[model samples]
Target chain A: MPYELYYWDGIQGRGEFVRLALEEAGADYIDVCRGPASEGQGIYAMMAVMKSKSEAHIPLAPPFLKDDDLIISHVANILMYLGPKLDLTPEDQGARHVVHGLQLTITDLVAEVHDTHHPIATSKYYEEQKEEAKARAAEFIDNRMPKFLGYFERVLRQNPKGPAHIFGDRLTYVDLSLFQVFEGLRYAFPRATAHLPTQYPHLAALHDAVAKRPNIARYLQSERRIPFNEDGIFRHYPELDKNAA
Target chain B: MPYELYYWDGIQGRGEFVRLALEEAGADYIDVCRGPASEGQGIYAMMAVMKSKSEAHIPLAPPFLKDDDLIISHVANILMYLGPKLDLTPEDQGARHVVHGLQLTITDLVAEVHDTHHPIATSKYYEEQKEEAKARAAEFIDNRMPKFLGYFERVLRQNPKGPAHIFGDRLTYVDLSLFQVFEGLRYAFPRATAHLPTQYPHLAALHDAVAKRPNIARYLQSERRIPFNEDGIFRHYPELDKNAA
Candidate 1:
């Protein structure tokens, strides 16, 4: 059976990570919320799962997947489940765990990226938190971003198989997710990541390789790929982008 | 052979999640960094694994587990690896995934808690960002904390196995982690969580139950249980606690 994905319809948000995996694997899946409510594939359908009394596993938020009777949530956890089934992870047990660990770290970096715009609270408007966001973005660009990106670069360099991929020579879901991170960072903080090609050469190369992949290339050019916007986790604010260079 | 757990020497931090599992399961393990450096079991030992070129999996941060040749990092990933081996997770595959999802949610909450004091930057001192910290704390108390706690409460209510535990009737590592979260919140934001007994009764009950467990009770009183301080993830700051009520 084709997988069913539940997420907000408007923006990519965290759902994009899961979407990247599904798109790259060319898996048969439905973007449930993007469909109409008349066909039982809209926000209501997603809310049904969220508010479902019968669901043994209630997802805290969207970007959850349903395959057969199994429903799983959390970006890293969902990717971990999909990775093996879709052949996006290493087969060995230890290697699998390593990939999972990398994914979780990526999850951490994404959360930090979200905080750049919504440092005070997600419930409030960005206008209310603009000043704090500027300060937060400064720290993120100066310290946290480099720290996280550098760690990933080191991991790629240390990968025994080759630096071409995060794990073995074959691409894993992590490599795809890293590419998304690179894409998002560039969109969100162009000046901040202007030197990424030299600073994070391996990640830049991986991003290029993943972008050139047949499936991902088609998905990127297709309407399926959502454009980055202010409403998304990675947002571009001119004032906050200052000092990023 | 006994597993080697590596984390910072002084504070509980994220490593406490892994330690709670080892303590509750009565598994043979070493708190590697807590031991003396002379015996190659201090921060140096932990750094060796992280910096080692020979190690197949280099941890992004501390709180990684070293089991013979295999090294796994990230709190939830480490617990997922240890959960099955230590028999802390539910037996069924679907149920196991549910527990993992819950653990990842808990991880999200912990990261937010860390941000309450360090909303602007982790590299900067709390004093440097005191105003931002206060604003962040207000939002955390008013919105984020309640949202996360309520979600878990709904999960407990929806659990087919009863509300005594998060999953089945038995205690999983998630329950232990929740107990720690409760403890940390109570310590860090006493005013914010003062009414937790009435608000999050299931979590309160779970915390109580876990605390009374023979092993957990001992662990709590022993030196192994590091007290919450400014150096750790959950820090008690009087200024940040304002208006929490």
Candidate 2:
């Protein structure tokens, strides 16, 4: 049976991270929520799994992967589980832990990115919290972004195996997620990220490299790859994109 | 040699999660930064590891564990690594993933708790972002907290084995972390969390059970468990805790 991935239908959101991994690996998987409701797949079908009291391991949220009897949740946790199975992680156990650490850092960075727009509340619309969002976005662009990106850049530059990937020489899920982060940041903060090629050359290069990968390259052009939208974590709003060099 | 756990010296912060697990398991682990500088363990010692070019697995932030040569980062990642070693995780691989998923959800909630006091920027003081903090805290108290806690409550209530623990019949690292979260939330939002016992009885009982554990009870009274303060993630700011029954 094909692996079943459950997530909100409209936007890529967190599921895209898992999607990227699955797509790059050419893994046979069904995007359950994106499928037809008549075929017993969609948002309601996903909700049923969460609400199923019969199942002892029901997930609290979507973007969970259902492989046979196992249900895996959280992007980093899912990636860690999938990494070994997909042959995307290093062979050594210690090195695999290092890759997981990198993915967790990316998770932290992604949360901060989401807060740039929804600073006050996820329940409130962006317009309702526009002033606070501007303040948060300013801080994110000026300080947090550089701190996180610089850390990753340093990690890449310092890698003994060379700077081609975040861990080891070959591509891993961390590299794919980093690529998505770069794409999202560039889309959300075009003016702020205009210095990427100059400021973070290594990350820029890695982003370029992932985009050129045979599987990832084809996946980007496919309809399966969701486009950046205001509803997603990284949303573009002119007022929040202030302070460009 | 004792396992070396590195984190900022002063506050409980994230390190307390690892500390609770160690204390509960009666494991020999050094709280590296908490020791005196002359003993070759302090904030400087932690910085040395992070800044070391020789170390390939340098952690981006602390609350990291140094298990001999392996340096593991992030609270959830560290716990996931230590859970099995400490015999705090279930024997089943699938069950361990469920525990990890729960831990990751707690990680999400903890991040939200931090934002209640520092809504704008981590670089800025609470006084600088007091207004934004208030707005964020109100949302947290009114919406986010209950949503997260409610989900956990449901999970506990719906568990097949029993509601005595989060997963299976044994107390995992997840339960230890949950105990810390409850303690932190009550300290930070006394009035807001006043309904925890009645609203989330299972969680309340789990908290009580964890505290009653002989090792944990001793650790609570000992200097090892730092008292929650303004410097930590869960800060008690009256202005931020405005709306409470």
**lDDT digits (tens) for residues B1-245 of candidate 2:** 79899998879998899999999999999999888899999999999999887667577888899988888999988888888899999988777777899899999999999999898899999999988898899999999999888888888888888998888888999989889999999999988998889999999999999999999999999988788899999899877775453
Those runs of model 2 whose alpha carbons end farther than 4 Å from true positions after fitting are: B243-245
TM-score, chain A only, candidate 2, equals: 0.98
- Model 1 stretches astray by more than 4 angstroms: A243-245, B242-245
lDDT of 1 at A172: 92
lDDT of 2 at B191: 85
- Per-residue alpha-carbon lDDT of candidate 2 for residues A3-81, written as tens digits (9 for 90 to 100): 8999988787889999999999999999999999999998899999988877875777878999898999999989988
lDDT of 1 by residue, A1-245 (tens): 99998899878899999999999999999999998888988899999889888666588898888988888989888899999888999899787888999999999999999999999989999999999998889999998898899888988888888799988889899999999999999999988888899999999999999999999999999887889998999898877785443
Q: B1-245 in candidate 1: lDDT tens per residue?
A: 99999999889999999999999988999999888878888888888778877655587788889888888989999999999898999888777777999999999999999999999988889899988899899999998898999999888888888898999888899999999999999989888888999988888898899999999999999999988888999999988784444
TM-score of chain A of each: 0.97, 0.98
Specify the CAPRI tier of model 1. Answer: medium
TM-score of each: 0.98, 0.98
